[model samples]
Target chain A: MTAPSRHALVPFVSVDNMMKLVLHIGVERMMTELAAEIEADFLRWPLFDKTPRVASHSEVGVIELMPTSDGETYGFKYVNGHPSNMKKGLQTVTAFGLLADVATGYPLMLSEMTLLTALRTAATSAMAAKWLAPKGTRVMAMIGNGAQAEFQALAFKAVCGIAEVRLYDIDPAATAKCARNLAGRGLNVVSCNSAEQAMEGAQIVTTCTADKQYATILTDNMVGSGVHINAVGGDCPGKTELHRDILLRSGIFVEYPPQTRIEGEIQQLEADHPVTELWQVIAGQAEGRSDARQITLFDSVGFAIEDFSALRYVHSRLKDSGLYQNLDMIADPDDPRDLFGMLLRAGAAQAA
Target chain B: MTAPSRHALVPFVSVDNMMKLVLHIGVERMMTELAAEIEADFLRWPLFDKTPRVASHSEVGVIELMPTSDGETYGFKYVNGHPSNMKKGLQTVTAFGLLADVATGYPLMLSEMTLLTALRTAATSAMAAKWLAPKGTRVMAMIGNGAQAEFQALAFKAVCGIAEVRLYDIDPAATAKCARNLAGRGLNVVSCNSAEQAMEGAQIVTTCTADKQYATILTDNMVGSGVHINAVGGDCPGKTELHRDILLRSGIFVEYPPQTRIEGEIQQLEADHPVTELWQVIAGQAEGRSDARQITLFDSVGFAIEDFSALRYVHSRLKDSGLYQNLDMIADPDDPRDLFGMLLRAGAAQAA
Candidate 1:
């Protein structure tokens, strides 16, 4: 059999290649670079065609398709959230994304986003912390040390110059695993007994627990004044990580208002409750942190543009890193109108 | 590198494998089987989660995502339509699709839909014709001789017993290419000079021209009584093939009215114009052909459920055919909560 044409092939970055890419570029540097790409896109957020993700919810889990375009390039991510999957020895969330040229609508690249999602989520959290965290913040109380815990810790160390990450999870094994993962990483990792102990002297607190419920991982008394809360866990309709009281007192900033009102921590608040758009803040159209003692919350419900940025970043690295395999995913006929003829020829070749 | 776990591997049927599968099963037989699968799905249509395709339109083309689920399995197709892409020596439409398990939210298979879509679209059209076409329909006039023309011809022959096909295209080379490809495929292929000549003795008139504007491929005078008009190419907003007068005279049947209203030939009619759901007809809940001489038009806009049916059909064939490769697309960790640890281990293995 003859090799497929270049037009028929799409560059695919598998999980192994993605890890190689990350380790080749170094996770911290890659996160910093990914954050820069995301920040640049956020700065021009109005140009994007943004819509709340299209989600299909079942009794067991939810599957979502998040698509966005900036007129020139279009991108979408297929992601699934199944909290029970972990018990079945499957990742709670797994994702993959595609980037296509707007002109021809041909896919430019396909990448495994399970690893990339963790990296981008942490990078986004750290990017928000760069704007909303208290000035001179040196420590981050990492609550809910699950799959995203170590990435979040490293992103803080790389992006926000945090010297330490205090880890805590309801399950002690989770906390211990997180501490072990971060042992050799350039950050002070602390395994704490409780959420309260994790927050001791911390100016930034990142909540990334993976419960598909409205259970509050942080209550009113647990939060301190002048702290920035990077809320990452409450991303679905009925799932919220912070308490309603915490939301009532904090000045919240979100990725997109319509989506955040439905999926973010602000879902607990009234529909019309005033909240700032994170893009506007990144673009200097709105304030991020006003006073040193004011509570600020970056309600992060991962958006399509962030995935687009990650896709763009990975595509940029493919030329130099050589970390992708081209799969014969598209059917390209030499004569555009002779698709049937192409099939006939392939059959003839096989017969020969 | 270590072999990825079963959880991480997604079975991918590339374009070559898809062609092999198609040829191995034989095109006519595959289309007949696909028609049966589509018919079975249509019979239980209301049980599926249905939605209009999510589309992103650009100046030269449009990119669309069509997603659907049947409570147990979820599927989606990523397709692009660029009418001008042909001038650039590219296929006017390219597609790929995925099928996933709703229970675990994990992808089960990914396949190139450029060929599968052609098969399914033709299968769907033929399936609709089975219920709506005049009894013992033999000759079909395929108006547009593009990439989809031969598929439609063979599917009609296999599904509806079309023994003769009269073909015509504005570009004579396309008609010639289609005729050459369909030469040995058990049908009397007639190359016609005009649309009127193509419909001379045809019982089913299929219009599938690929102009991205309001195109009258079949005018009122061109269509006759008792004919099953399978209008295929008037998909996407502002692109219609038949004249409104012809539409007013026909008993229209559609697959998903909400989408057909915007992207089908009925886009030229009133928003509240009466149209029968083809699924209802297939399920025996609605009438298909009321009289012998009545004009019955099956307005084919293509739906997510058709693609879902195709994915399901292709997935069923995988176990027996073994015409697929496992792609390391998902990141599966031993502990599920250790996605970051998986990355760390991969990195350490690389370093060693």
Candidate 2:
């Protein structure tokens, strides 16, 4: 048999390179592209393996690994949520992920998912809104103006054609920061005092609050008919956004039913409470937005498939930009039996 | 609040750095120190939050994430198994792990576990033997000698006081390689023709095969009373070393029962069959061996706690040597709300 030829090792995109690539690509264009990719992946949703994220929760917050595959490529995101981190001047959440070849079980790429996560999450929201939100929705109510607020505003502008964003946060400075960041981005930005003011006359309501408990950011009275609610932050078991009454009244949609049952707004309802998986609606396998006057809820808990799509998109983008560092993570032994040889070579090099 | 002092970014030990550190420390010393750490951790096993590892199996092999936590410290290992990788001059398994603080969910250290795994596996095997193997059990029958053979031989010498190793592999070159690697390491290493020949006059038999299928390397007839079998390679579904009859005839011990049920030699037996948890035995809650003539089998599937202990031990060593590089993996925004500010700073630095 011919000796096995060594294939070039896979390139890894470090956090520094990822940030540089994002800056070069322009965050808005990247968000728009990421949203398109998420939508495209959502359209072929059945082709992917899906599972609720495996989460390890502590008394403070949670750490989760979300994994999914499409029979060819496997992807997983490592993320942590520590709401109290903000008190300590850390982002409430941070993430990173890997994309690997299923054929060889080799990690093909690793990217910073912290910034990418914000972009993909907004993109996912935009993808859902394309099907679930009312046509020609121009105004959005954004609750909890934090790290994710800017991306959400821009994604709404690019994907759903939202021209106005009414932002509200308990901390007024956070709302001001969101508005200042979005200045000159061609959006009518309004800083509101409360969720009620933000939701007034808005076509879409988005709640991305970071508290690790059940906080009713949008009450039943605040939500209007013909509004699509993008509930982003109420993701762990005890954390929730909308009041249970609002979920009971609205037509609910989720990325994965099993995960949403325990983590999304629907977690408050019984296990049997019916909700439509967003993929079914995106694939035209189920209905979305039955009536313009009826409230619709896309209970977004963040799924593995979105990360898969995001990683694929980032890998492609990095390739086009020629931006990424090759991480020497995998050992490429000359002889499979000679792992010790690599160590010897490395040791000799260090000694020299 | 004083702007959250930039989060102390976690230090990452790349594969190259890890290899250099291992070579600098010397493998035998590292293995000895790792064995001590594993023993210490095993003794305090009840202080951990343990669970069966999460595995994703494909036709080629399996990828697993093994996570465990003490009340204060948490760690997890990401490893992949592909037996055919050796044919491509790649290691059958490659792994990396992280140690984090439970209080902040901040990863404190990241290290390549590919080499560390071999060291720790051998250390763990020797640790188990020290407690369960008969006193003065110097002659060890190492069946299916492969990449892990040299480490196992060295660890047996340092930890279990074994002076000789009888090695046998399906391929004679593997045994020769192991023998060559162990030359002048103070062990009387012998290459044997078959598993039966290797076990001859040996008090301990260790099966460390790589096949991803159930193959009985040892039968009841091949084993004698007073022999300790360290079963290491039968570590996934459909992979096993000993015959079911051998387990029935021997006093079986396992790392974690739930994991071993699906991955170890006991996988072939009925679920309700009684077996002693190694930790319980180590904690003195259960018996290890009733008599010198009793047969003891350590059906190890490689638990996460062992990896946690290994990571902690290696991190400590790396710190003492000052050998690890700090990875810019986590974003350290000065004004927690100013992640965008980091981009501006990077841009400004570039301009400067």
Candidate 3:
């Protein structure tokens, strides 16, 4: 009745504000923090209501709604992956997310999630590598140096203390762009001509190509023993990056089995292909790297809980950063039963 | 490489702007137009990708994501229902929605849907009543005079030429508030002390009480022959308004049977009980109001497509009304593969 109340105002983090926030707390430091946040959520995986993402797939792309709730707070992300979008100078994956209170069923925050998704995806990869990678891993072979390449490179340096990264892509310009961006970020950036060349001395190899087909970006011979394979880009049905033979030789670990079996690299294997749950490994309930010669694969298709963690992290940062704008998203009338009266008063105010 | 492009900016309709837009068009006229739009979408129901709403329920309330795509465009609404919210001076229901281009998977618009939802629910009820109500229906008996009551009253007046509305609520203050709001709206408003008194000579009866448990708002004896019942508030599992005998007497019509069977008033009836699809009736694929003596009921649980229609209607009106603000919601890089470079450039611009 007296305009919208404070409860009606949801904090919104725009793309501009998100970028400012990333810069305010340097990208590597933020990813390190995001990694810790994601790991903490992983520790309490059983408490979350993990709903498989509802996807609306068209011929060109897919739009998805991924939702999860941790009893007290609920969160969801609206994301789209359109490989064809790149040709039109649009991000292949663009996203936004919201967090709401479970008790009142009111939204708490709305944030642009494209950059945050990138950050969280990278943070998740580094966190998994922390559990599954060989000890003293120093170099990472980054194949398909697209938007996610630099983030993965930086996260490894921040979370796992990796000192160098070797980059390669089908598109050399992408590799060159990644190398240029990673120039002064303290990592030894090497632009390689071939995937094999990039993987020469690396202990971790990440494949993150953006095509929607089952194209093999890595083969069995290219991946050696003791290498942790962070397969980052095979995230939909019929879309995979590593050869089936490589998955056969590795100890596969995933965020969620039901989803990863259909969308991750394990889609190439049978339904019961025996992939370890990464959360169990992080919580010390299961073995990570059983030996130095074991090839541990973190089949990264992303999950709702990781996004929920990222949103929660951003919400926690908002009060200190003051980087969000108040959005009049919810309608709060003075008398909850008099919504129409509120509208009538609004009309009068406009007329005045 | 550069700043966000025009495509990155999505048009956002806040609650205040939504009120201004509604007032600009006038509530009755907007509901009339919205009814037509919803009817049009109902006619082409087969073209849509109908995904059941994903709901997260807590002890106190429930949050839901309802999504649908019409091949070319996709829309989703985030809504929450907390019956206990009113006791804390909060709305019992609140919502927001987004529309995206299916081809590129890019969001085109974001709008506060709390007000729009009330308008669409009313419009849908009136649209259904137009086909199922007795011919030349002139009076509507609104049983629950809460937030949704006034909208329902006005929609019936605008769409079905309802000349009078008899309003009644468990609490008299709600009825008083509703009566005051409808005073100068060109319809004869009557405040009734009981449910039976509200239905004195009305041909259309609308029940829209907000409670989480089953309650008998109307019985079979209270509903006379040829009355069209608009059941609005019984929209979740275990929540219903009409007596079981009343449902047995009425020819029930619904939105989506799979969903309505679980959430609508039909939840009180047998799972295999006969209920007509309202879209089929709108499309002439099924009969409506077969005979004057046969009672008709619209078990209105609401649907994603109805919300889709409302969003598309609002998007169409935005240009002429100019009541929206641009939100930097999507991330658009000069080169889609150079997202890192864009962030780097944003940092450089910030430093400059």
Candidate 4:
């Protein structure tokens, strides 16, 4: 009997390998490349098959499956958000994703997305900020300095040319951790005691707290004109960060309106509230940062296409990097229709 | 840094390991046990979160993600069907699946499900037949003798009281392959040239052809009264097996009605076609095989919960069986909020 061919093997990047890959590429350069990949996808957004994530919400948190295809390749991410997990020494969010060939429906790669999600989220935020933030913006504020804070700060510096980042969080240890992690990251990092202090001299304010309730992390009084607000924490139906008044004052931009309406800060507004699709702006079909004093807010609810781009980028990177292992994942018989015969032969091989 | 806790490691069953597992457990006994697990889940169908399988369709075929939860355990299957793949010497259907803790959203097991899906599909069919087929069903006619034919025959012998299987395929080579595989499987196996020839004195007929279009593998006159027809193929939109006249005559039962309307044999019928939910019939909430003259049809599209049960059953079986390897699939930091620190430490450890 012919042995299972190379078709049965799928390359997998585990958490250890993912971290190795990130360190090998250098996080800042990875973020910049991810930003470019995301931008390229956004430019060709019309070619993508988009759908709102299918989520299973429980009392603790939610698990979602986000899938998309760009006609040639298909990708999906399995992600979870359980804010209470942090108290138990577990990440509030965890993820893994897969990329597949559209022609044969074969999985190309599977990778842990906990780190990649952070990179993509920050890259997406920086991409939006590049389009919507005021001209000559150099200072950014990172509120709720948790696991994503350093990634956000580095991504902004790498993608949007931000020179300094001011960090603030409700917990002092989180702020200290963020400050220490960003010590040598090529950016001027400042730790602030209050959210208002973090926003001082900042042209961009990013909120990424791990709160599961409808608490206002960003209010109308705090957001000034011409500053872009990247609201990242509020990504569920009952959980939001920005106030309704802040949403009314800002011209909101979203990855997908159908999803943002149900999960983003705009969930506080009317269902028909006018919001620009970010892809249109990136594709040059709509205006971005129209005037000097325009309050442009990207109410970012993560989308499937961004994950697709990340997976595609990682799959392309596998040729040069040996940080993956081949998994005996697919069952391939010598003759495709003789699956039962293959099983029998496998048993006999074990006996032999 | 502290070592990652056990929760961070997910058990992964590879193809080689799964084949060993099936052989160790004994195939017929495993299928019969799987039928019981499926029956138990079906009995509590209302508790599950059910949705139509999310599919991404290309020109050649389709890839689907099927997810369902019983509020405590969440499971999903990633499966692809490409008829063109067989011509290139690949299985027409290949799959993998995951079972996760709903409370924490951490995957407990990642398994190669191509073999498992075949097991579950055959098991589920035998389960449905056990509830809906006429009394004293000792013989079954399996048309389309391809990959699933032997599995269906064995499952029926183990779950129901079937003692013989008559097989027929459009391609004589496929029938010969199936007959060869099932030669010593403790059942009377017959190979025939035509579907009508195989159906002689058969009480059940199972159609499982691999076609992407609406092809009639089973016509009206070929089906007799009181025979249970298990239609396994034609599971996607614009694909079906039995002719429309047979569907009109048979008392149809389906897994999920909304999904069936788009992808089952009843797709040939009206949108509002009156059909019994198979779970309700199994739970004694509805009737199955009301009379001897009635033709019963299980228009199976394969639901998410059945895969959930299959995964759950597999997980349960993995406890004493050391048939899996731990994958470092989740990133667990000493401090959950310091993911950057974890990556930096990983890099340092590699360098050291």
Candidate 5:
């Protein structure tokens, strides 16, 4: 009991440390590990107490809190999106999250999720493709070669066994950066001039554009049968990726249906529009892909549960690697009722 | 701009350091400063984006997230309540919060609020008493002398000119502890055997009992004609402190009506029951303590805006004090699209 109490102090991995840790682990390995965690979590999805992320939207941006508990463990993430942040030399999306012991409601770990988000997004995309894409799916079309593009490309290669990636972005420099980042990764990287060119001869199509407004990066005419569409960027209300006709044609899958109705591609459809939750497919309650010619779309609006899983994975890996620092975030009073005494003792020490 | 960027990299104050800083500042002085900040925030309450807190409830307790923004600044707190936590040598409540820049949506500070909650709750009560309590009110009766008692007593002393506190609790030891904590605070502290006895000759009454159920600590007979009541403990859907009749007899002031309607003493009242927002009173748009003998109730169930104010206050105080460490929580790529490159660089550094 004493040993467990002492071990209860969970180590926190800050953004800088996380970056160093992920780099040490290698991005490809990190993505593979994250995907495995997501898959493991999705298999036990019924054990979770899940809710749609709570959002506070302003004219300029939205701030959200995403919380979930797996009976004994709890997690939450705080994230914000401001499209105009680029003008201020900041990323439009930034986040941090925590994992806690549900039995005691004590936070065990706090982590930076900006990089984790990129990794998890890519991992989730690959996870969906593993079940929905064709058996010999080796080539992926990466649309919107932004901050998350390289991660998506690597996750697919590492998790879904993809050998080639064709990239396109409205910003030519972004596509070039994506290509340069993947220089020695051993995958065939093609920087295309148009989304259509990137889509040609690809088995998987991933759209992760960061436009804040509704933009059709993929149309029904551009999409082909047997292609697994990983829709990653159209995550908030009024922000969408595929044309309506494309969504109508594809067998759309989502993380959480209620959330997907408001934030995913389904937002453009009626509430009654049929969609299969990814957890259901993972849990074997529903089929993922019916045929080789089926057009499958994973409407990948980010969910809190994924962050919870990612945080837990990072915490476990950091513990195993002995690479994290303990954050003195909780007030550990010898006597729980002696909070005031703790304050006074600190004051007395300062005075002396 | 370069200097500011460098300043942003400073280490954050650990929870221990924040406690030390707060203690060094002295509780009374800290509460005084916090009350001023709350007052200033309330004056501009109309500028904020407010929402009811998101709560996840279980049989044992609840975990909640409270978020609010003032167009330029965003803040949120993660808190939990478990009345049985004391039996396990844990606090019935624990919390931490974040302050973020609204323009870029980046978390600027993350600090433990388990201790800060005590201070802010007391300061918020005192701020309300400043507006609603009788002029030069000097005596306060504190019912339920538990974890929050001393802070409440000191805040009233510092903010509302209260010179005496009469404390009472079901447990004689709790009352004794409260008396002992306030020994050197230069106030007349009396331990009372009963709530009615504690209320005698008191100009303001504060109830902060920690029962999880609807337990009435104050009855209509015990509350005097001119006393302003600060109700703190009745902050969840089922928990309440004062009798419904006591609320009907007094003019009720609330922080965020949508929230108070569900968590405050007013939860027992009808949906149409009229209650004045405390901010309106602070703005002079509504009446506060209309007559000399009229009872006033500041139904403080705690609000997100108050947390925002407290976070802002802490950020300002800790900026130059060298009490905080900068958390590398945000991933800032030289080129926003080159996140993968940053990871690669980190990997190279680790290898070297």
Candidate 6:
């Protein structure tokens, strides 16, 4: 048996290191790799221990813990969403996650998943669209123009080969900021005043708005046939973006049925409403878009397996990266039964 | 409105810092404060959200997330237990926890909970004993001389005014270590070979043996009437310390019914077996010790609110103590909608 060392430190990746690592790999290239990782995990979806997130909801916001394991490694993310937090100069959501060894239950890596969640959500959305959206789609109508707008644009560009993004938000300043950020990024970025204007000549319609109520950002008249809709913002209960009539006419695909029934756009439908599992399509057991007139919709609610895939991808890249710090997180004693002895030694060391 | 600064930082207390803080406050004093905090929270138990822990069980061990909130602050502990880990020279249980602001969903503190959990578990045990044990209880028979043995002795001394501790274990070296650790800690410590010898002339009996099977550490004939039992180690399924006949004769008080029914000693009983919630006792709504000769048992499976109280106590002590370091764990953007802008700036700074 190998002797256990006195130092049982876990590697920690802070927001700064995460940003540096992403820039080092280039954002688009990172998104591509993350998409591939997510796709690979989705292909073997039955191997995972899947559960919908455990959420603690209050009047103002909700905090959730999403956990999953693949018999080898376990991962969980702690994330919170408060819409009014943006008015208080805080990001609407913040997150952190850890990956642990299944044998010992010791945390292996602790990472800031705020940025990684954005990446994984976008990667998941684009991956779904690759199997659902029309072929050779070059234009995406972005209806949110907020924190996730640029990521959604880049993910589709890198994963689904989109060359143009038409952006619009209720707030003109948000559209200006998005247009300024995506300038000279090799895509035709157009700013529009109305959601209908952004949808003009668009083959992929992405509605990602920020609200806690059931107000329609997309109406039935705005959605055209033969286009794929990536509905991003309506993730939690009582929060949806599309009208009920629009959902009735489209073929909806979901990440997980039980969760989507409670938190996704399909929450508007009956609990037993039929929706195709995206993994089934990716695994070649189900069909994607069948004809030119079919309207496909991806009710994009994030799941634990996607976060596991992102953490797995990060762990694979963390090897020899020199981009992390050691966190003295675990108490390691010489004799495992002598935890008191370990504390006493620390007291003595301080005295010396 | 106060100007919202573009900075979001979380305080982190490492294992070293936790030891320093504990020593600074004195372990017994910290235990006393933690007991007080736990008692205070238990008094208002109906106001908090209570749920059984979210657990992921594997062949070797189990990892669990215990979460609770008091409407203002949210706390959760990530803990693991594996009995065979000690043979591999690793702790059988290790943990960490986070406390976050409920309004904005921002993490406020992250602390290593391996040592803190030890403190809180002992504190909770002693606190429960104060209400159930016979008056003027001065001698405690600690029947498992393991890592938790010393803490249990000290907590009883600090909280219940115990004057002597009798230690016993199957392994003589464990008993020796417990005796050595408690030599100058103001209480008299005695090492014994067997449980019967340890329980002689003792008013309180604490069985905390670390085994994963339903082994009898305490028998029916050995546990005399009028003695309170603090059962701490039988915290998982298929793990029990006292004989079923002994449990049948005792009045059991548990943390949470749904949890204690599965993990505590009461798992051997029928699903609707009569057990009282300890919070009801603390709240003066239920009976603790009905008479001096009645056998009272506190079946503690360790609830989430106890961990919350411990974290609350530590967070209060952390103010201006310089025992914690700031971790840049949250993403703070000048414009909450401009997360992409923040990443672009980071890239520019790295290139510059």
Provide chain B TM-scores across all predictions.
0.99, 0.95, 0.98, 0.98, 0.96, 0.98
Cα lDDT, model 6, residue A251: 93
Please name the candidate that would achieve the greatest DockQ relative to the true structure: 1
C-alpha lDDT (0 to 100) for residue B285 of candidate 6: 96
Report the C-alpha lDDT of model 1 over B225-264, residue by residue, as the tens digit.
Answer: 9999999993989999989999999999999999999999
- C-alpha local distance difference test of each model: 0.93, 0.83, 0.93, 0.91, 0.85, 0.90
Error of 5 at B188 (Å): 0.9
In terms of lDDT, the poorest run of 10 residues in model 5 chain B is B1-10
> On residues A1-352, what C-alpha lDDT tens digit does candidate 2 reach at each position?
1121233244666556767787788777887888888888888888787777877778887777788888788888888888888888777777778887777777888776777788899989988998999999999999988888888988889888999999999999989888887888799999999888898789998898888888888888887788999999937888898899999889999998888888888889999998998888878899999998989999999999999999999888776887776655666566666666567667667778
Write candidate 4's Cα lDDT for B238-327 as tens digits.
888989999899999999999999989888888987999999998889989999889999999899998999899889978788989888
Clashes of each: 0, 0, 1, 0, 9, 0
Residue-level lDDT of model 3, residues B54-156, one tens digit each, is: 9999988899999999999999999999999999999989999999999898999999999999999999999999999999989899999999999999999
For candidate 5, give the lDDT of residue B350.
Answer: 58
DockQ of all predictions against the true structure, Cα-based: 0.90, 0.45, 0.79, 0.76, 0.49, 0.60
lDDT of 6: 0.90
> Which candidate, 4 or 5, has the higher DockQ?
4
| Residue B21, candidate 6: alpha-carbon lDDT | 90
> Candidate 1, A249: how far from true, in Å?
0.9
Question: Which 10-residue window in model 3 chain B sums to the lowest lDDT?
Answer: B1-10
Pairs of residues at least 3 apart in sequence or in different chains that clash in candidate 1: none
All candidates: TM-score:
0.99, 0.96, 0.99, 0.98, 0.95, 0.98
DockQ of 5: 0.49
- Candidate 5, residues B1-352: lDDT per residue as tens digits? 1112331242555657777778668788999999999999999999898888887777788888899888888889988887878788887888889988776677778888888888999999999999999998999999988888888999999998899999999999888877988897899999999999998899899999888888889888888798899998837888999998999999999999988998889999999899999999999899898988999999999999889999898889886787887766677766666778877776666567
Candidate 6: list runs displaced more than 4 Å: A1-7, B1-6
**Where is model 2 more than 4 Å wrong at Cα?**
A1-10, A348-352, B1-8, B344-352
Residue by residue across B1-352, what tens digits does model 6's lDDT show? 1122335578889888888898788889988999999999999999998989999999999999999999999999999998888888788999999999999999989999989999999999999999999999999999998889888999999999999999999999999999998889999898887899999999899989888998999999998989999999938999999899988999999999999999999999999989999999998899989999999999988999999999988899788678998777787778989988888888887777
Candidate 3 interface RMSD, angstroms, 1 decimal: 1.5
* Model 1's TM-score against the true structure: 0.99
